[model samples]
Target: MSGVLEKIGQTQDKWFVFLDKLESRMHEICTAAVPEIREVFEQDRDPYKRAHGHLLMGLRGQINQMRSKANEVREEKIFQFIDGITSELPGHGFFTGSHDRLYTFRIACINRHNLFEEKIAFYMSLLNNAAGEQDLEAAYQEQLQAFEAIRDQFSCKQCAGQMTIPDLFFIATYVTCPFCQTQNTFIPSTGAQMVLHQARSLAEQRTAHLLKTYEESKPKNSLLYRQYLRSMFDEWNKIVPDMAEENEKFYQRLLQDHLNSINHY
Candidate 1:
């Protein structure tokens, strides 16, 4: 058993070395792209063309090339590494009788795969943004201020009556004018629209402890998960009080879906 474990450890170390070299190469190429992207941002005065159009074409092209190179490395090198450890070595199998060793080997492979996948995602996100960094909170606050400024400044389509929106809503909803009593459908900004979903994620964060408790349990408890889901929905409803009626229906649907997925979970 000790001999088998030693061999497996050596194989895992070799795989890690291959990953390190690949990652180093990937970083080198991506770093070379940074200056060109910065130059594009500085030179392009048309904001739309800078962000989503022609100015980004070169960077995107380079990113695709790097992605292709990484994929090729993953296929040729990663599989070869696995094959070296498991199949190509000898006729005498190391894990034929040892289930524990087999499990560990599979787990190690999965961890390495997951690490590469995350690294790829990070590179993609870094490449996509013009500034290479985003101030999400600042953007959200700016959007909120814009919404607040225009919230009360809408005219009734039916009577041309000035009406103040009573509440901030992300999605389209009927707003009744006080003077004309005409229900005008108010459409919110795209940023305001996403806030409707962001509130739910915030609620999940508030109930993260309950979720952790359920997830960390051995021989997983369905009741604990249900409790966590209920608590999360409660928090969600509290955050969006006006959406409580709609949220309740969603909560029921989510619960039923989760129940149906218990076996899979």
Candidate 2:
């Protein structure tokens, strides 16, 4: 049972790594395609050319929607997989009650939340870029400002000696701070407030690492990047069998649901 538990722990680590790689590849595909897609729209002006341009835009939008659905499915699978492994391991109750398991789960949840936020940023960027290509300057500016504001808010919190309750609420708008035992109320900062410089630095480092991973995985040419992305999808499909069948079915249903919506649009 101990050996089985150890194997489950190892599997969790590998699955997380796989998710990281898959996400990096998806980002690479979208990032690389953006410029090409933009250029295609820019150089075409005739009615037929315009129609083709719209088709390309639709295709890109559909792909983006699919990617978002895929991420959601992946997140669900990740949590379910973690729970399953943790459930089956030896001395389940003891392990589940362990501080280490709790800490690991908390860390995983944080990382997953951050990844979801980043994916939202990525999608917004794509929309802004597309708007710019379409010469919708006003809409593009609106979205660009919104994205910048989000970045600034995060940056402001990081730079402050101590964040006010308002700032903490802004930084983590979705979750209550566990430290202050506060819910939706701002905690006042004292003059001698503790700095989160180390935590902020660590967060920045993780962002940089993710960016570096994407850069390294990116292909030098669009054709190659597209192929790499296709390969990743194939790999994921193959590995789904190794995962829980319920998770596999969930992802498939999610993909189909998203694709159906795209078709309707």
Candidate 3:
């Protein structure tokens, strides 16, 4: 009994020491990666988020490596010790004290692991939210104004007739010339192409107050969240009506995910 207790204490101490070192490593990784993430968010010109996507994938791989190390340590240091002790003293009379101490040690380890997971999640949230630092609404408006200014400057290729773009088109579209009765392919400017990429963010900004209202609710009002989501999608569809079908699917998925979170909570 005394031998088992001493071994358990030694294992717990080693486990805690490893966890402390791992936590410090996690902090260092997140601290070093945050500025890089923010820089990518601010400077990366690709609307497809290719650079940020690669960064996140690498970060996630590193975090997962740390998680794997933690689990391996737990299995080797804690589980092995417990299993060895249980087998060595199968019919011993030290079950009460040994079992109590083992249970406490296991709980402590679990709590530490959970805390590490939560910390990782927090760091990820901070990294992902860095993209919101840019003024998406202003970008959207600037692109919209630019598009409006040059919309009437296009000429038909077939007969050289004047053409007026009747709508905000992010991609190349066939524009029928009024005078020549010919189809002209209209391509938007490089700046105008960004509106489609940032439309959702702009809509979210426009409806941020409603989201705040929902978040501020005592129990987190689902109805308020639905109202906010509906308004946000409405604004998004308003900005890019051509994408309404795809946006509706995305909106439904978001709403379902929110509901799942609430239920799980």
Candidate 4:
């Protein structure tokens, strides 16, 4: 599992770096095309050519919007991935064997990942429509698929072969092998217990490394950092379900007190 987290952390870091480069390239393409688009308008006095500039302008606008959304989605997804991998350690004995800071982090991470996945799907739809070249479109689609696959792979903690409680009950818990019933107490330790512990340790180490890298690599713009923090809080705010019923009771009590005060007066 730790190996999985480390892999996910590395992949997520790469994804963000790739997005940054891709966005820069996309911006350059748009900038380069702008003058050619303008020249098309200037050279051809035809009404069709004049209208072509408007079409180009619209395409440029759409592409820019998609690019912006893609970056936002990428950042959110990266944060979520980091959150998920680090969070698991505390719950599964990462910390003091009790769910604590690590468990909270894990839940936060899962929520963020889920939210980013939804947002990315929307961005991808926009990309599909805005992309001009067939090659570019194909490349973008491949990246999107890769991102989804990676996300899916990171969501689970254990391998398919890992024994579940039910499986354990049937195999090791209940009936001993007839030939080896006397040897039942000679149960050898499954490597899974050791591997799981090792995986958590590896995940924690990788997460700390990634966090340090991200902090060091981040732009020094305070305003941008503030904006990023705000966005993270907004994303976090969306995670919990509403306690409408609880709020309604409070409102009812307040209303009742106000009415009683009026009646006594």
Tell me, by lDDT, which candidate is best: 3
lDDT (Cα, tens digit) per residue for candidate 3, span 115-163: 8778778866766665556777777888878888998888889988878
> Which of candidates 1 and 3 is the stronger one according to lDDT?
3
Q: Sorted on lDDT, highest at the top, how do the candidates line up?
A: 3, 1, 2, 4
Give the C-alpha miss distance for residue 229 in model 3, angstroms: 2.8
Q: What is the C-alpha RMSD of each candidate to the true structure, in Å?
A: 9.1, 27.7, 3.7, 30.9
For model 3, give the 10-residue run with minimal summed lDDT. 124-133
TM-score winner between 1 and 4, please give it. 1
lDDT of 2 by residue, 1-265 (tens): 5554465466456656755665676577667766766667667664235644675566566556655665675566556656665555556346444336535754775576467557646754674465242333332334334445543332122233322322322122432443443344333222111112122222333244443454576443334433443343443433222233544465567556755654675
TM-score of 4: 0.28
Candidate 3, residue 70: CA error in Å?
0.6
Off by over 4 Å in 2: 46-77, 89-99, 130-265
Per-residue lDDT tens digits for candidate 4, residues 215-255, read 67555334443344334333322221132344346545755
Q: Once superposed on the true structure, which residue ranges of model 4 sit more than 4 Å away at CA?
A: 1-5, 44-53, 65-76, 91-265
TM-score ranking from best to worst? 3, 1, 2, 4
Top-scoring candidate (TM-score): 3
Candidate 4 clash figure, as a count: 3
Clashes by residue pair, model 4: 2-199, 87-106, 89-94
